[model samples]
Target: MPGPVMPDQAIGTSMRNKDRISAFLTLLPSIILIGIFVYGFIGNTFWISLSDWGGAAALAENPVKSYVGFANYLDLFTGFLGGGFRQDLVNAVFYSVMLLAGAIGIGLILAMLLDNKPRGESFFRTVFLYPMSLSFIVTGTIWRWMLAPQGGVNILPTYVGLPPLRFPWLSSTDAILLFNWQNLLPIALYLVSLVLIIWGLWRLKNNPAKALVLLIPGVVVGGSVWLWGDLLPQALFMEEIHGFNTATFGIIMATIWQYSGYTMALYLAGFTGISQDLRDAAMLDGASTAKYYRYIALPMVKPITISAIIILSHISLKMFDLIFAMTGPDNGQTGHPALNMYLTTFRANDFARGAAIAIILFIIAATFIIPYMISSYRQRRSR
Candidate 1:
């Protein structure tokens, strides 16, 4: 049988419990504050998105906010009022893809070059990262001036005895690689097939049998769609051409210039963390510089690349300030959902529709973020 606990020992135990209680109390206020401000607001926004609350009297005290289900979402996706919304959605998708590719690719190249320890490495690194130090508003304003149709970059040609280029940088209404918006099903199928094919090729050497299984279905579905896409039902009776807006080129250029330095910094840190002994061993094994990076260094720093992608992709989704500064509001050619959401809510007084757009953006951003979060969580669990 156990003896009675000593009074001093009991006091010590009680003191530890009190300390734990005190620690929890210290955190409770912050947790409550965050819960209300962050999650509570998010819930309120989602509820507003599902309600009928907009128009002339939306801002009035005690305004009517009746639940309307998904009417706002349906209208944005299919109704006549959705034309600008759809166009902005397309632009946002294209922007995210292009920005991710350009920033990550360029940043990786710069990181690799810097890893070579060239002369004046610190100066060059500073020069590369200098753009990131400037605010997006400043960057956008500067680029807007440079890309103005009659001045800046256009006039540089005249200095070389050439005609001044008259290309419209941000005001052009033209779009290239046009596709019918009504063919969403066929396009989706094609995209799915392309993903499968890429997945198969990526795993070809590791598991040829599984690769063949994925590849065959992808090829069959993709080829069938390519050859007989006309058989598919149209999403809409009317034809709508949506494509890459050339005007966005100026915006994309400015975005890449501003963010690539950040990605470079991430990749540079990753490269620096790599053991020099490993690089020396690769060199001793007759690995060329290209092969050294391709086979060794790159694979080691893939996490940095993935992190950069997630950050940049979400940044692309919420691209409002730069676009607004560059082209102002509602310039269909350079509009994004974020800009459209602002105008719809504040300027156009379509609060419900704006809320829907915000929800859509939230979902899109989640698509990039949630997967990475799950991956990180699984990695942590495995460890």
Candidate 2:
């Protein structure tokens, strides 16, 4: 600390400081642009969601906007006229679950098969991935015809002397797993308890103390819900039933067919990066091919799986083009929140409600993305 700085050292420090200043100046424009455009638009959208901005006045040059707090959001959730939105929300949940399961499962299987290096591996890989090259609109149009009630899939049985299936693929009225919106509080609590209990059970062997902490609260909440759930106030004065509609089956099938190949490519890349020597060592240790993949390869590619889930979850949330091409926007049987938002804003001239719907979707997307980002940051810092 007492030594005087040498000429070369002092020059080096000065150069470093100058370089830092140059870098910051270069990045300043982009930072300002993003702040004004992206975050600014988001903030403006949120403000619109909290105001009254709809009807014929919405398109006016200086539309009168009055703050309405969370009225728009409340109306979407519990208002009598929100029945369609409620059903669409339920459909979105089912769509997300089925898409994640089907795409990830089929992709994993396809990747595993290709990893064996069969003859014509390149050709098979290309064939499997070809569907992903087409746009959603194209895929939806193709599947729409193939799923027609009397023409395509339904007529396959006729080739073997069986009568054509009479089941309607896109216009079915059947529904299952019905639940009342009136009992929303209890159902939500039950779901929370289930998630906690499942998570605790999964971690029980690894960290008993932490697991017990999660388990005990989960049990208490579940027991309270079971014992006194009826005391909770109903979300709606009238019964509003929602469930998985049978009509969405065809749309889901087409989505899986289109996206499974994309996920398969993701998994294949992850599998390819693994060291061959490591795989050989596992085989030498008496691990079967299935065990090698299930226990070794999968764990190594956890990042890839997480990435796929995040991407698919976002895609499922904003699915519009495919649903539109398969069943038009007016088709109540295959309605989605994105389509509903469009109709409410443009067709019905309800700008505030549309903004509310957009905010809700944004929040839901953040829920999936924020946790992943935080975890990734923590992991990098730890490393």
Candidate 3:
């Protein structure tokens, strides 16, 4: 009942199957190489992190690595010697937050200005983006000279017939907004209450039911904390003041200068992608420039904002070269996990502990990346 298959048709089908096999074979080597190199190394690193491999033995060619379950991690977090790591972690958090705020805010402003098609727009755009092309080493070296106590920025005030700034730019040890680490529990409770109250207020008009649900817990927690604040358990016997370090300001300034322009470019591209017709429509509707951008443009380019945050935050976490080039190693004010990891592994010959630090960093970075990945996946599924 079926028609006879033609030789040409059979030959064509065979050829296609062969082509697919050939194509797969062509890519097999690369896939195997990647699997062996990238994932293999990552797995080895994780194994090392879970082992006891350090000190003099770590530098030996035939180092003995014994399996130890999370001792290194525990030491880093709660050990007496880990004070530096804690301070470095705090610095990293502050750096990431400040860098994100400064870079995004400044970039948005620059993008808005350039969006108006001002005179010499191309030249200005090029100038702003030029800094991003420079390596961190170059940027750090330049900034180091500029931030020197007696040389660059401090002397500028003298040129204007004002007293030179004696304030320590890179060597200052003072911190502001200091809070005792012993009160972490109370502080955390207070922060939670504040967040709930803010969320309730935000939702009051549109979702009164949810607002009340949020507000009730917030009020109860806040009132409880106010009444029984002293009853909360202290995390430490002595008060440990940790706050924003003034010494990191110079590094922060240099980082902001280098990266803001890159964010500006991203925003500019986002702005360009927006249809002119939408702008015309907003204008016809009597929307001012500020309102148009605030209400329409920003909402449309939110993905770009999220991308910028993820990129900049990871960059902040991985900051070692710039910090090293600027301030060198062991400066608690500007020390990041990356630098600490290097010092631990190479300088101290503590391979296992270094591996633990690397894992912590990897986990922290994953915290930022994984959420975005899941959200993106969910969005795609929804579409």
Candidate 4:
């Protein structure tokens, strides 16, 4: 009574307890999300992937219960996922690789241009980023209109007198590259790598001068693309550019265009965070543009590069909506990676195989996403 109940100092323990409870409350929603959305889905899918049932056919009180065990997995790994079991998995992998390469390569360049603040930087940035806000369906729809056989986009070539404008890019393989960009990705990276490796090897070899010519990294990368361009079918040459069935090509082009802007945004943000002083210092030391980007900018934004690659890979892995919207699920068994899964699951209502295919996609996404998450954790810790 003498000290008036010593208001504050009465109990530090109570305040500490209150603080702990508040911290737990603050994290409650996140914890719930991790449990339900993340862990729960993972567990549910994992169990589903192990079964022979899928879609509406998945639930039934049967005698033997099939006990398919890992048969579904074998079928998935082999070719049974699509019944005839073609190389659907391989095709998906290929498409994913293409998407990743296209997004990063074109995105980085576009991002750099946008960064330059050239005329209409805001407009261009929006044009590039707007797709990111829209659903893949929207992206597919818009591109489809542009690439349709008798669309306004095709008319431009005709109007300009280029004249090779009648192909439905998504249907024909002729405009081969008009939209076959999906395939060009791996090829592009291959070309770039080949040139670099060739030049670097040449440099490492006997003649230093020849090596110098061969070893210039840029030259090597440029040559690879030139060589690849030389290898496609002659009609793919432009005269044939407009006539061929380029459905596959169109898909490629669609993917490249839609995803590139997103990658560009990622790189742009990463670029801004880099210290301008370091870049200027490199310039002061007389570093060439190429060298400066290669050494200074590249290293500083390595995380962004990794982030872009990981993101694109995941996007490619789960790439269902775009493919479906553009070409529907018809050729999915062959060229449409997500096609086989969607058609089998929804239209044909083949749940078992469809879920299996989705599981396969999940595996792919996990491969890239998990590592990136781990890297992010490490990054946070370092900070």
The regions of model 2 sitting more than 4 angstroms off are: none
Candidate 1 clashes between residue pairs 3 or more apart in a chain or in different chains: none
CA-only RMSD, every prediction? 2.9, 1.5, 3.7, 10.1
C-alpha lDDT of all candidate models, in order: 0.92, 0.94, 0.90, 0.67
- Return the TM-score for candidate 1, rounded to 2 decimals: 0.92
* Model 1: lDDT of residue 106: 92
Per-residue lDDT tens digits for candidate 3, residues 1-383, read: 98999999999999999999999999999999999997887778888999999987787889888999898997786666786787787788888988999999999899999999999999999998888998889999999999998889988989889999887888899997777776878988998999999999989999999999999999999999999999998766666677888999988988999999999999999999999999999999999999999999999999999999999999998779889989999788878888999999999989899999999998899899999999989999999
Worst 10 residues of 2 by lDDT: 330-339
Model 4, residue 268: C-alpha shift (Å): 1.5
Candidate 2 colliding pairs, count: 0
Better of 1 and 4 by TM-score: 1
Per-residue lDDT of candidate 4, residues 81-196 (tens digit): 23333344545555666777787889988877765578988888998887777888887898878787787578887776787577657665332223222244445555666776
TM-score of 4: 0.70
Give the Å shift of residue 314 in candidate 1. Answer: 0.7
lDDT per residue (tens digit) for residues 158-196 in model 2: 999999999899999899999999999999999999999
For candidate 1, give the lDDT.
0.92
Better of 2 and 4 by lDDT: 2
Off by over 4 Å in 1: 1-23, 209-233
Which of 2 and 3 is ahead in lDDT? 2
Give the per-residue lDDT of model 1 (tens digit) for 36-86.
Answer: 998898788888999989988998998988999999998887776687888
TM-scores for all candidates: the values are 0.92, 0.96, 0.87, 0.70
